[model samples]
Target: MLGSLVDNVVDMFQASNVDWKKIIIVGAIFDFGFKTVLDVLQYRSQCRASPPAEITKTGLIDQTTFIKSQNYSKSKLRFGMFERTISLFQNIAFLKYNLLPKIWEYSKVTAATYFHGGDIVAGIVTMLIIGAGSTVVGLPLDWYHTFVMEKKFGFNKQTFKLWVVDNIKSWVLALILTPPLLAAILMIINYFGKMFVFYLVLFMLVLNVLAMIIYPTIIAPIFNKYEPLEDGELKTAIENLAASQSFPLGRIYVVDGSTRSTHSNAYFIGLPWYKQIVLYDTLISENTSDEIVAVLSHELGHWKRNHIPFLLASGLLNAGLNFAFLGLFLDNASFFSSLGFNAGDMPTVVALLVFSDALGPLTAILQLVQNLIVRSCEYDADRFSVRLGYGENLKTALVNLNKSNLSSVDADRLYSTFYHSHPILPERLRAINEEMDVKKSAEKKRQ
Candidate 1:
């Protein structure tokens, strides 16, 4: 099955432009047509294989009946219909204006072969457009989750006042920061063409390092207040643990996490000199300081392993692939003009997303590979925490978190592999158990 899938993907990539478009259209149609079929199949499989199959007081319906009833609901079937409807409206609105075409016409790339000057400017502008447009999509989803879902789950901390303030602050920050960075990208792409990816990768690394230097000290404070872990046993315990590990963290502190949700977490943010582990107050209330230390240690392991660097590299590689593909596809006039973008004035930046959208399968594969690697790192970090003598504490924290957040413990491997950045609860628990055995053996040797 995997081989066939891989072969099909490779063929799609090698296919001619017309073939590629046909494949895209077919994939999109298949994605729409079979959406409900797959969802229903997976849902039914889960339901059938579910634990504790208790014959309840409510009359039993056979699987056939249940399937029929679910199909009749028609909710699953509407997934593509809703998406298509939204896209249709968006196309209609965009089509009414030659405004975008005029803009593209103005920004036309004149370079014969390599990345041109105009292409870079257009690319940067397009990126900003996407980033801005995405913020529009993302902000609402975040708000919905924070205000509605998280609140319903009893996790919210902020008031309407705080929420509004945070949103405005975030938007202002994006506005202040995005344009110049984007402009720099335009300059590089215009000058370097294909070589722009190299510069982008370097720029991203520097950006991440800068963020590491400043995030805990600056950016984070803009949203939440942080105070030193109070003068108490909790503080002393955390400090002692950090000292023992020689972990180069600046301070242990608490954030008012309960203002949003009952779920608790702890994280190490910023670089070593400025590194601070911010524990949710709710975490302090529930888990012992030991567990918090274990959690912090795991987070510290992420830093030590330079996992963020790994993530940054993955992002840059993805961007490079995206840029290359964009260069390839954007040259095709039909894809551009059909989408209401003027081929002549085609902003390289906007065309970037259009190309990415076209290369959807490759992006998905890239993300999937990256996600699988990240999940493995989560296990490695767990082991690192165990080496610091906090394996049990980490396990305890994970259990508590799962309960508080109401996440299922026993998700399928495929589900976790596909969607989870962190390994699922059972897998993590198993890893912790293995680490505990190693710890006991080391202690016996010490004795």
Candidate 2:
């Protein structure tokens, strides 16, 4: 029977004599060290005298812009490195002193004392405690990053009171929604027992679908205002472009993102048959209508090529694998003992926390592959836009966007591959130009 096989596997794990605590600590250090190396590489690239000749040749990125972009990027990188170091040490110390088990015990006792002794209730309490702790610890860093760092770079638009309100709203939203969601997930895992991975993945898929449905309609409006894009020549052009591509354009909403930051973006969200595109008001304000439509052509390229679905499928696969990986270690008795608990009585919530923290370092190594796929898709989307006769406009829009955003257009190859989801600006421009040349050649041949 299945029980017999599981027992044998458990016995084998017991015999392995793995010191999981030390192993996890070493893994964390190694992962952090690798990332630090990437940071150093990026710093060197950013410190270069100028950007590549290709980017300079376009006469788009002037010396002042290039220097400003490098300085901004380098400053952010340094800030990020500092924050990450703090997080790394905190995690290491948390594990070293065995705080997770203590928190679980406290949550369990509290649940028993007041919540009528339910596992789900205890798990929810445990998560809330952890969330509160994280929020408190991160508050100062968040404040400094927003008020000091971003403001120094001329990006912060919110007043201190507005920032405070935003944080309070986020906390309230999390408090209202998180407990029930966590409890439901715990229940699914408990109900499925050994086959939890299979059921958990399905539950998560359903949850993701529901989130897509509710986020724009319900969740997003809570934080910011969404207004219909006004009737204009721009609107008419966007409609015609979508019609030419047979895109299922439903509604266009411009979100009030300028209240927080000057950065611009555009993305589509909805179910298969009814896609909605949301543009940052900043995007509309900053770009020409032609450029905005051209930028949207690149976005439509993502939909036309099924990139979103591909990413979704890949994400689900990754989640399934992570669940399976967790399953492997769940019955590893030594791991529980190292965390000051026994495998037989280990709380599912506690086990999940331990596994997530300990396994993250190793799991992160897989990110390179995901980044590679994403970068390729960006190139493909650019090419798609080029094929649609938006190549020149897209390039101009991209340049302006990059300049406005102060994006680091040049990057070290290794660091870029390991970190950036999109190709560097110069590389993207080169690819776009090549695609345009190819289109022109094909037209000539046909003629």
Candidate 3:
């Protein structure tokens, strides 16, 4: 069956005279449109469903807040649909007009004239130009989403100046970092031929590790102020929790997340030896000390369960698979020709985009699998908090977090399957409540 499907796809490609650019653009639109329509339908269906009796019975939020959350969800969904539709049309226009190839050619010629090196330097320069241009083009939509949509919902906490600064910082960072990475990958491809894929995977692995190490100390501080959690009962409780779990807790810092949005979150960052915990200032303000401790316990649970290393290993595996497919595409002349590029003259940058597009369906499958893994890990982490006797507190924190963020606590199951990294609030609350019941029953039996 699989072989027949592959043969059919190949036959279809062989029959079509469409340039690879057109094929990719059309395929992208179809793929995105299909997913977007399905998601919107799901959103609409959820909205139409009678509000769950559990929602009101649980008393997580008042009716007003519940209505507000539903409106927020629908508004975001409608906005997303609009954004994606516009993007799809823009992409079609861009490809149909051959703007990408034109830009690529222009960048190549300019870089060659100015740079003393060979194609590698020119390739890097072209990529940088293309990258910067893409970022610039997307900025307006980003501004609207951040400033207009979020502001309407009372979530925007950023000034226009801060937004501009962030954009500038992002572009500057990309300019500084991306060129060398592209240069190295191109050099490897030139030097090692097919083995370039394996080496590229290793390069990515090392780069990710370096990012993890530098992110907390270097990159993050550029965005938000991070102050060490001051001497207080909350600090002491967190320390005690870590000590009890035999977890090597590093410095705890509170980030000024309120500077950007009202969202509350907690995360663990840095290497094991230099591990740090960061709590959003909004989380600190919104939640009690016990609830905060409960949240940290869940985070520590991820560490205790080796979820970080597990995710890293999974990422490396995914990279290996991607590069393997990339190697196959690079070796196939027909693949390049199908995409409207002469096989003989295909640039590394162009080939990279084609390789990625070719593997889109496979990437989607892999992402779905990864999401399932992530959701399972979240459940395990929740259980870990329960084991630490913070189950009730964690449940309370989850409820409050969902309420404050205006997140729909219950989502369409199918939608959750595709999109949610963590279980919906109701599912999590059910699990915690069940665990508490079991614990209580055991205590009663002992008495």
Candidate 4:
């Protein structure tokens, strides 16, 4: 049975003809150029908008703060351009030289000599080596962004020691988790043949669920401290809001977000039974209790509207499609050979990298669609918060959050459509105000 399958796979490869080299080069150029143009256009748009002379209805910043924010945005744009330029050159060089296959060749030989297993073991070792190499190469950029840029903006709180420790912990965790997962994938392919796509999708679904469950409990605590939210009016307000909304109330915990950066955020972790709401300590210090409750109300709105499940379903659909295409390419030995790999000599990890690159354009289009959905969801959630009679408070929270995070309040429509997963600060504020006005008008009529 295995022999017949192998023969069939080889035959399929022999009959196939695809210009992988041309496809990769075109995709790389298109993605690089498109993103670079968008970045420049967005930056220009921000620069053209003058800071309000006084604080406006949208909570426009004072001139000093506005100037600082502009500078911060410019610095980030410059850094992103530098990073992307480096990445584009790196990717082109890697593809042109077929470095992945070379790395795989070296890894397989080393694995056979030192390790006591088959292709799966060697593939895992190869993937780890590649991952480690990439991480080391990118470390300087990450360090500069964290210690230099963020520090200059007064957002960074991470010491060099903490940064190093965090990276090491991340590496250790990846090592512990990745090999088994990769092995399972390889085993599925070996056993399931064409049906591997279906099984792989199943594996990914299971992995996603497990990650959601594990992240807040086992993984997150490795980096930051999490303590139950103190007995306070904030906690009482949050509980009351959740109760009023019929939202599942969970144990509220505060994360030491200021340990790494002054940027504030709030999110929930775990499924229904084991859920917890995590508020950044920075957020607590920066905003009022009502604003905090308003933010939580927005989050609860996501749950109430079933956005999570919808997102998950969308992701699963994408995964299924991706896995199906990947299985086809992996089985096609000619595809590997065209990229300087020997026919039938491709590793699973290498195949994944190549396949993802080949599908880059398609993936980008899908991402744009996903962003539209996400932005719509954001609007819906904002309306939900307003319906809870916290529209003004939520608006205040959004303004403060944007200011604290140094986020640009406005961007070009095209840029926002392509990149933003939520409406810009001004748009969100307008929506909230409109909702509030409608509510007030209805109340006056009733009176």
Candidate 5:
């Protein structure tokens, strides 16, 4: 009966002469429009008359810092609005001009000239062309954000020469990596055909694991220098904490994050038995050893709770769903028509992009659910940190991180709930306080 129902639905869908182009364009509009509305809400929240009393009364942030933070938030919001508007127009232009088809044709010619114009080779060329175009489009915005706005807010630490060097390196890396990656994906699609989704998921899972191993150890150090955290109270304390938990600790390195921005953070990486913790040099400078340890306690809590695997699993599920949907559009001639591809000659890459964009609302919905789950994990990690007796220090560290970074403290409930993977600072603090109270009460009972 279920099979019959699904067949009937599919038959109805096929019979319906849906305007695929219109559906895709409309979805883009709503996707961008909805996010714009949320940003506006968040902007309003940031525009509140003053910082929260709890924050100010505790002297976590002075009035001057609060004002700076508010202004910073407002500036970013204004910038975001402009960028989104530009992006919407760009998307429209790309679709209306049949840019993908033009680019795909160009890629085919280039491939024919060089690589013999096989579909897989042409597909790789097409993706690289798109990537190059996107990189060109985004560079100016990225520069203004990094150099102009961030410098205006006193956060940009990178020199112009360094920035230029960084970009050169990034493009070099992309050129080296993208072709083979695109070829692999295209090959899987060609070989698996109808079962591409399953194969793609497995491939992506391998890529994710490789990224986890490579990014911090290999890729990141190319951009920023890292050094051993010299023997110190902070290192000693971190080691002690790890010892208590029987965590397999390896090398502790401090990354020169201050070279680019004043923002601070710490995280752990590597396989289960030989884990490494990396602290941003900025985090060491901005925070006391205890507060830094407290921050890392929360980070380690994530490891303790296996949040990395959970997040990885969630990402796989998301990718699986994405690929499955793309597979449905494989035989979709009308969808190819919408993408400006000849009905029967549709490339997997074109179908992937068009279907992904057309399904924007669905992805946004998925993002909200993912954010909710991630935020819950954050709360749980906070509780774990508190249980480890770092609650007070963690609270102070949170305040300092926000103050240093000029982060917006006030958040619209809807916007925050929909977008943020971690609970806002105030929410985190409140939860930590509640957990502390529980801990203290339990201690009293034990006595």
Candidate 6:
């Protein structure tokens, strides 16, 4: 009779059960599989034949040599060590408790209890752990990459002091903002449960709007000084063209772009009160005002077409998907509690971090989609520029800029598809020529 009762109890538990041990095993397997695959693919892709000659064909030291001169040994060593440590620890955990089925089963039962209790402090604590860990491990690697390697390549203009100051300021910014935001998100998760997706999507859209409004006026000035375009004929020409196009451009600003790096490009940074077009001094030194105007016109095209709003809408949709995925993990308390999380323990925040880390490949896919839209918008903006003034001038400016920087005219299609935000120079030039031919034909018919 006792043996029969015990067997019945086991059957009942098996019928309605959440096994947490299986989950841990799965996480370990996923981590190992992802890291191995990514590492192998990245190594295979990077190991190309002799460095492209175009990079060094210029009289200056080749970009390849400059890049190689920078010491990445420390970063490589750090990454390898980190990966090994994670793998080792996970293996140890698995070995110590071969009874994943039982532990995981218990973790699921306790998940709800932990969720009920975790609070804001829990979120903040997690943030500090992650922030500090990233700082200690990631910062030095970046320092070596930028200051040591990029400087050797003649790309970095920032002094060590400047770099240190920037890092401190960045950390301060994170400290000020991230904890509260994360805590608030955790609070939201508490009430909404899986329904947190809608709120999260709204929040992302609002954030992007806020950024568009405030960045040029406030956030940008912290990193670089800005002044109105100097009193010159170039300024007059741009203003005149703006008036002709009914472009609501009030001012053009020049930024001290060289303070941080040698790479140069111009961009429009904000909305309305903060709406300003910024030109890089490097651009000023390289191109005529006519060419600069053509560039500015392209930026204006983005604004005129409401591309920013479109981007924001797309971003919100993407955020919705992310929060939905997060909801799946958050609803199951066992999933997180197993990973050292608790309910009153800020489970949402902790779970979020882990979910985000797990979702890296998905994030990459979304980024690729965003880049595709941006590249398409760029071509439209280029067409707008040609309609407003000079396509040839823009092309000339592009050619000079590409040659000066040793920009890769051609790229491996797969690489460009994966990594490039903008289309390659050859593609851009070809598009411009096609537009110009259409324009010329239109003008002849009108005559």
Candidates ranked by TM-score, best first? 5, 2, 4, 3, 1, 6
Give per-residue CA lDDT, model 5, range 208-235, as digits (tens). 8788789878899899998999998988
lDDT of 2 by residue, 290-392 (tens): 9999999999999999999898877887788788667766666788777766456567777777676567654775676778888889999999999989998
A best-first ranking of the candidates according to their lDDT comes to 2, 5, 4, 3, 6, 1
- The residue-by-residue lDDT of candidate 6 on 102-129, one tens digit each, is 3333434444356442345645654665
Top of the candidates by lDDT: 2
lDDT string for model 3 (1-447, tens) is 998986665565545353566657767877787778677766775574445654555676777777778888888888778777876777667666766566667767877788765667777877887677667778888998899888988999999999999989988888888888888888887788968878887888898889888888899888889999999999999999988988878899999999999978999888877688999999989999999999999999999999988988887887787776666555455555554454465567766765666566787777788888888889889988997889879988988898889888667777778778888888888877777788889889999
lDDT of 4 at 212: 91
Q: Identify the leading candidate in terms of TM-score.
A: 5
lDDT against the true structure, each candidate: 0.63, 0.86, 0.79, 0.84, 0.85, 0.66
TM-score of each prediction: 0.75, 0.95, 0.91, 0.93, 0.96, 0.75
Q: State each candidate's clash count.
A: 14, 0, 1, 0, 0, 12
lDDT measured at residue 26 in model 4 versus the true structure, 0 to 100: 85
Report lDDT (Cα) of residue 443, candidate 3. Answer: 83
Once superposed on the true structure, which residue ranges of model 1 sit more than 4 Å away at CA?
1-144, 305-311, 330-343, 441-447
Candidate 5 local distance difference test against the native: 0.85
Q: 3 or 5: which has the higher lDDT?
A: 5
Residue 201, candidate 5: Cα error in Å is 1.3
Candidate 4 lDDT over residue span 258-316, tens digit each: 99999999998788655689999999999999999999899988888988888888888
Give lDDT tens digits, candidate 1, residues 181-283. 7777656666777577677667777887888777777888887778887798778877777777677768777888776567677877766465677888888
